[model samples]
Target chain A: MDQKTAGLNIAIFFCRQLDANQDKNRRAIEKELGLRIRFFPLPCSGRIELLHLLRAIEAGADVVYLVACPEGACRYREGNLRAKRRIMFAQKLIEEIGLEGARIEMVNKTAEMPADIGAIAMELLARDAKVSISPVRSNAVASFIEK
Target chain B: MITAERKPMAEIRAMLAPYRKILVVGCGSCVAECASGGEKEVGLLASALRMDAKIEGRTIEVREMTIDRQCVYEFIDQLTGIADRYEIILSLGCGAGVQAVAEVFPKMLVIPALNTTFIGETKEPGLWVENCRACGDCKLGYFAAVCPVTRCAKGLFNGPCGGSKNGVCEVDPDSPCAWQLIIERLENAGRSDLLEAIYPPADWSRQQGKGPKKIVREDQRSEG
Candidate 1:
């Protein structure tokens, strides 16, 4: 990871069904990328509300991503689709408020791809090279420096 | 149910820019059912405004509250004590609900977050269609329960207008011809005879020609 990616704070919310070994995967990804990552496992991605996504950004996560089960694969039938719509809605809201909609993202993962979480982290790190730190975080830091 | 949509985010942001402490009040009745003004929506909007303020390096205090119903005085009373804490009340209720809240807190600056659209029915998930005009005159019994005043592109009392094609309205292809639906329902009910009786011009006076309408029932009110 580059210096910029190393300092990035990422939060990933995923359906528990996507990965059976979430803790192990989270640890391996963090160790390899030298990045701070928070994993929120939900019973189903449908349980994610717009507030949860926005709160993540407000809580200093430079990037918040939801990993859902592939389409037609959700045991609940449409949970993944619900999560995708909520992500899109949240993205629009943030974008309207002058934040990058790309800050929030959704990825559909199949059970076969156990290492997908690590790959997602690596991809986010590479993406960080192209984007600046979240303005919400930078503004807070600026305010603190002023004080 | 009364339907409304959240105002454009830019308009809302502009209205809120002047206030530091804001109370975003939502209604749990019609607006909530329509997904524009509900407890969850209130939270989403408040969180968004707070984040926007943060990004601008401005401090804004936003609180969220949703009453069981905003148009009723009893439900609106819930904001009495806490509302005093905020400089402005941003209501996510319908027009009636916004006015009711403003009436209760006459001194407070209450603004609407949603633009009241119409009386509608939820056709499907996330789709609400206007189906009632509240003309104060009941004519559903004659029209097989399909209201032409609201459903038809033109409120034709004597309809068919000879403008429909393939059961679709000529005015709007997306909308099915209301008169056709009425005629089909009447025929199926063996009441095609009703079509022969011409309906006289509707009394426009009963529908807003007089001004804001009011209904009072003595039996429902407590005695003085």
Candidate 2:
């Protein structure tokens, strides 16, 4: 990890169906990359709401990532599609407020090996290096790395 | 229902530039159903505005309130005590609701955040089609339920004008010709004979020839 990826606060909202061992993989990625990553597992990606994405930003997440089952693989048919639409809508809302819509991203992955989760995290960190810190990061909360 | 769209962000930001404390009032009735002004929308707008203000290095206090109906006095009265605390009331309601808020609080500065569009029906989710013009006239009996006065480009009393082609309007290919809909509906009902009587031009006096219109329903009024 370079200077930009260091101390970056990443919030990942992923579907439970995407990974069975997320906690172990999350810790492995944090230890390897020196990045502060928080994982929130949901039953399905469709359970994600517009407010969920916004609140993540409000809570000082530099980049919010959503991981869902691949298109037709959603246990609840169309759940992944619904999550895609919501991500787009949320992106539009944040963009309207002069924030970078790319700050929020969605990845579709099947239940892969534990190493794949760490790879995804690395991919996200690489992407985050290109994006600037969130302007709306609240002053009240300390950086996840600092904590 | 009365349909409306949120004003562009640039226009809204301009309207709110002077105010530090703003109350975003949404109408839960017509505007809510149309998805323009509602509780959810109010929250989204408020959040966006706050973030926008923060990004600009400005401190702004934005509050949100959504009443059941903005056009009705009983519902709009709920804002009485809270409205005075804000520097401005940014209403996401339709035009009538905005004016009603201003009228209710004569001293407070009330501004609209939405552009009142038309009286429309939800054709489907996220799609609203204008269906009524409130022309102070009822002509449905003559032209099935499809309203030509509002839907037709020319507002022809007797139509399927030469411009109509392939059952669609010449002005907008996407919109089906209103006359074609009316004729088809009438024919299906075995009322094609009604077309024999040529109707005269519509009387405009009832719609806008007179100044603002009002109806005083003595029966509904409480005794003084």
Candidate 3:
């Protein structure tokens, strides 16, 4: 798949524990993006690791976004802050290794604003398309076609 | 726990280009504890790979799995059958886990998904600070358990280096002088006398170097 398809093939790891009507957020995402997002609920956003974001990229996610509560607004108090820092660290690593750092993202979204989820998803999709595919990936694609 | 960050989407996509099927292996140990990598990452990788590559009849299978510990043979061996199904193994563990996977499955290509840094602790929820060097020696007993090799900006063995200003290292103003911390910890524990014991230069051979190290158990030996 090209960068556009890659952007379309997005995956989100909703670290925050879902609310009583968590399906509403999930349903909105599916309807807007036409992407099946697999949710892995965490006790708190602090539990999500930076390696999870990296491995997701390795496994073939074009855009990996984290959904957390606003800063200091986390029910667990420190969960959102931890998630934000992880996203920052992940971006730094990505930039150092010559990849577009925008592929990994973090945003604060409450259950109240389900439409914001769609906006964030679209933003991520557009952002991922802007990233230039590495020569190694291009070569891999070329070789795969030959086989 | 070791601190690490995620590999970028473009970079990871490039690494897995040659293979159609890929295994995203997560370590539920250190990396998970540090928030550097884990099983939740597997699903993220699978989606990204599917998006970045588009080809006719090209099937990219993304599988997610986690091991209790990827540093040991027992844990690595547990992936026998599941590993064979994937053309490439993307390790979300530290450098040691990636090497262990590569050593066990020489036939398959192994790729690292995280950049492992030094041993650190969660100062708070998101903040991690380097705390140990794993220098293959026990100087901590002599230094009140505050590690100079890992925390000191210069890895100083002697007293606080002259570069220390107001208990902060010159190399990084934000970094605390390890010796200062050590001394305070020692003073509080009433073990200030241990500071008088000079530390000898560490032997490089004892620490990880040159090649792989191994140990044999004679206590558990049985007659053949």
Specify the highest-DockQ model's number.
1
Residue B49 in model 3: shift from native, Å? Answer: 2.4
TM-score of each model, in listed order: 0.93, 0.89, 0.64
Candidate 1 chain A: 10-residue stretch with minimal lDDT = A138-147
Q: Candidate 1 has what TM-score? A: 0.93
Better TM-score candidate (2, 3): 2
Tens digits of per-residue lDDT for model 2, B63-109: 99999999888999999999999999999999999999999999999
Best candidate per TM-score, number? 1
Best by lDDT: 1
Residue B120 error for model 1, in Å? 1.1
Model 3 segments beyond 4 Å from truth?
A1-147, B54-59, B191-193, B208-210, B220-224
lDDT of 3 by residue, B59-168 (tens): 57778888888888788888898998988899988999999999999998999998898788899876888887777776787778888878887777778988888988
- After superposing candidate 2 on the true structure, give the runs of residues whose Cα lies further than 4 Å from its correct spot: A1-4, A20-36, A110-119, A138-147
Candidate 1 chain B worst ten-residue window by lDDT = B203-212
Chain B of model 3: TM-score? 0.84
Residue B96 CA error for candidate 2 (Å)?
A: 1.0
Tell me the TM-score of model 2. 0.89
lDDT of 2 at B135: 90
